[model samples]
Target chain A: MTIDARADRVTLAAVAAEARVSISTVSKVLNGRADVSEATRERVEGLLGRHGYRRRTSPSSAAPLIELVFHELDTIWAMELIRGVEDVAREASASVVLTESGTRHAPGPEWLEGVLQRRPLGVVLVFSSLPAGVKDQLRSRAIPFAVVDPAGDPDPDVPSVGSANWSGGLAATRHLLELGHRRIAMITGPEDMMCSLARLDGYRSAMSNAGHGVDPTLVRFGDFHVQGGHDIATELLALPADRRPTAIFAGSDLQALGVLEAARRQGLRVPEDLSVVGYDDVAVARWSSPALTTVHQPLRNMAQEAARLVLRAREGASVSTRMDLATSLVVRNSTARLVEPTEA
Target chain B: MTIDARADRVTLAAVAAEARVSISTVSKVLNGRADVSEATRERVEGLLGRHGYRRRTSPSSAAPLIELVFHELDTIWAMELIRGVEDVAREASASVVLTESGTRHAPGPEWLEGVLQRRPLGVVLVFSSLPAGVKDQLRSRAIPFAVVDPAGDPDPDVPSVGSANWSGGLAATRHLLELGHRRIAMITGPEDMMCSLARLDGYRSAMSNAGHGVDPTLVRFGDFHVQGGHDIATELLALPADRRPTAIFAGSDLQALGVLEAARRQGLRVPEDLSVVGYDDVAVARWSSPALTTVHQPLRNMAQEAARLVLRAREGASVSTRMDLATSLVVRNSTARLVEPTEA
Candidate 1:
């Protein structure tokens, strides 16, 4: 892993040229020289910090570092994304630095400022949005950044990588419909997120295509967490037996697990009494009891693409700004044909 | 989220004093001035980089950064640790920078050098070993670091925080013994890890106390992964009926899931045909089929303590070098009373 020595040299030279002073003058500011005028000292210091210029004593070193920002770092889903990004970073001989945005969508100004001082070669925002101010700051610093599964439809100029959530949701719902489930329910992520809306739209399309008009009452919005799934599933399951849905399409595998837990509490066996289909075939999906039948969204591939795009951009290459990976259905034991009611 | 401004001022002042030159001369060297003598320039430059002298233009800023190093970033277990550290960091107004060591026990020299250049307030290493050379470098630079679940017993001077693994293992095995499981099997982590050895020792002690000598063939060493548990359990289940164990204790919840998978493939019902116990009652333990009866290691608490220890050390406070949090048994559905065989 060789450090980007050329980048350091370029930054030092640029700082010197920008300040219209000898390289030594900028170095003096870094060393806290009192001889330089206060105005000149401040200007050189600003450029030095902004460009992250440091003394390059060694030539061969670790690869350039890339910053990966996450809204939160508690879920296994984030782990999958981290694994994917690390895979690409390793191949590129780069290191990855992970930081939580300390908020749900936009990073705080303080976080952005620290990032600027560190001067990562590029940045990858996972399930996060780039605030306009941050975008401007990064652009001004000449730092490349890309988004992975942006929470909203990103601006056209912002590069991003995501999966076909609409298609995945459609396939998941279609799987349940083909299993002879009519009174089916859908549990989706936060209603405000674009991906969540896309998935819900897909579910609606599949139901309507199958001649079953959309039932708004049967759709519940969740926070893409287990508790969210559990709470909603509990309410749905508590409905009158005759009106209860025989199948469920959970937005994520974690939610699917929660649904399975709800079924267990209600004394209903999976597949036999209630069929479930999930999204994002994370590792735990295979280990899940009865195994999860889910839409296989390539989380790792999406992360890799995000990392690749940012690295490419850093290299001054012209690359597509948007990438949507394919999603497929994985048949497993979680879904089955709904048994017809026996004659009384 | 105030930055450690005092530390930055002290570093610059210390460098100037140590160089035995006017502060302006040191500044000239920092600015890359050609007029400075080569000998003076070399001495000042070395001190500047080593001390991490950065200009402090802001009085109030984001908290100092802390680095958290992991051997790999693939497991939910790692995520739990991250969450714990992040909790403490957030309270301290510190931001965490996460990095993967790319190796199992030791972070490479290049990675360490980069970390030094970043000049983090402190470092928390999860499941990693500190090489003597690296330790010396960190000490010489006055950077404080603490280990969380160190790969091995660390030097007395090195602070660390870990769980009571032996007690947890003993409690888990005792729970199975109390349920009349005489022929019990143990699936532990790698033989090289100190925690693994402690767990295996606890298992052995329990068996001996019960007057049941351990069967060497029933003990398996794994890598603390799902497949490790699965493969070992498969081999154990393949034995002749009379030789098969009635209960098994897996070192981790992930391994227990594999054991469950193995039992399922063999058409055995949990707690009826085979009782099992697992360690590390992670979130998945509650949602596993029949739920998992395991030991709770307080992983999050352990992480919080590690972060706290490093921070306390950074504040020039004297503290204990080692901490072992308590672990307890969490009885769930995976274990039950063994049914006596009826005479044919």
Candidate 2:
């Protein structure tokens, strides 16, 4: 990661001259200082980007740091992602700076300033896409960035890492089908997310491939949390004995836990009375009373890939713009073979 | 927050003169630059500590950063602590820098260098104690530090936050006793950990207070994880039916899940055939099949207090040297009144 290797790199002075601004003004704009006017900042940034101007690094200024930004860090999946970044950072002898900027972060002018000042080697964002303004800011400073998108959505212009959500849903549903379950219910994430739609389509495809028609009544949208699973399962379980599904496939592990709770409330035995399958084989999936038969999303590996991508890009290495890792089903004790109704 | 406000602060130049070194050498030592010799560095640091030298902060050098060092981040309790620090950092417009230096940090010589370079506002250590060398390094630079120790044992010299582990254990056992459970079993953490010993003592006290003798054969120590709970419970449940316990108290929520699985495998229904109580009411407690009756150890709050203490100390405010948060019992569906054996 030396500066002079790229013989074609543009000079800061050239960018300043092209923008018709002083070197100091260009520097201020590069550092994300608010002193420069918005128009002037944008023009300087455009010139810097077009010229492919990479900032010169001083021994003192090149801090061993990797910045990680998330929409929210309270989710169960966040820990796995953090551990992944930490793994890479540790090997590189770098420390990770963590920030939780909500989705409403407008191009992250507020958060972007901190990154610019810190001048981290690279950034790993836990979002589906980076805003245009934010992308420009990072590019101008030569601070490479990549997104770790769990939603299976990515911006065409941004480098991103995601899991095979469609495949995960397909495998989860197929496990129940193999268990001889005909009445299987599916609870997916919010309908608006691309990952949710992809997963739902996979579930439909699995049912279709099994020589069975999709039961519209057995499909429901969930919020991907425990409460969503609980609420959806509560009503689904309350249906008539003949109509109630003997198996349920949940969108996430948290949701699967909710389904289990609902089953326990009604005196139903897991794997015996009601089989349940979960997505995202997180810690709780295995720790749940009846370990969930679920799909592994490879969250940690995805995060590691994103961080590695950003670091390599920062070091002037060409890398993949998009990488989708595989997901697979893990059969635990939560699912069982379907049995006939003994009461009848 | 300002340099002039602290009239009693020692000067760097004075320390340099007293240590027979140039001001530049002191500067290098403060920056953690490796150019300085170890002998000179130690002498200069000793003089700085003795004289109480406080580094003058320039506006640009004051990074809005908080350093959090953990022995390991893989523990289940880490996420909550991270969130607590993030809460304070967000409110104060500071970002958290995380490092996972194992317990063998050796006063964090490798980690301390990075922290000194970052010049964060303050630091929160998750370990029970900081090595003398590490403590001296932070102090010479006037970097305030605090510990958020879950292990109960904490260094008296360090400002720390711990929970009422003894109370948690007592409450859990008492809950079982109140439910008419006489043949109760207890699973504490590793014997070497202060928390484990404290909790064990609490259980002993609770049983004695209720005029009941604790059955020696019914007690066991666990690793505070799911596997530990399961392995221990399996053997306990396998004891002769006449000597088998009617209730069990687990060391942690993860352990409680293991116990639940053990009960299921043995065809024993919880809260009916066997009541269970868990310590540390983490997320899994509520999500468990039969929601766990647990002791809530305010982990998040303890983290917040530790972070707050560090920040306040950094700003020259006097703060508590130690803070022990309270623990309370949460009655859920896992515990019930003991009923006579149906076989009898």
TM-score leader? 2
TM-score of 2: 0.93
lDDT of 2 by residue, B1-344 (tens): 46553542337778788889888898889888879899998898888778766665543455889998888888889999999999999888889999998664333576888888788988999988777878878876778899998999899999999999999889898888988888899999999899999999899999999999999999998999999999999999999988899999998888999999999998899978899999988878987878999999998999899999988887778988888999999999999998876544
Instruction: lDDT for model 2, please.
Output: 0.87
- lDDT tens digits, residue span A201-234, model 2: 8898899999988778899999998988999999
Q: What are the iRMS values of all candidates?
A: 2.3, 0.9
Q: Which candidate number has the best lDDT? A: 2
Local distance difference test, per candidate? 0.78, 0.87
> Where does model 2 exceed 4 Å of error?
A1-22, A34-61, A104-107, A341-344, B1-21, B38-40, B50-61, B104-107, B341-344
Error of 2 at B279 (Å): 1.2
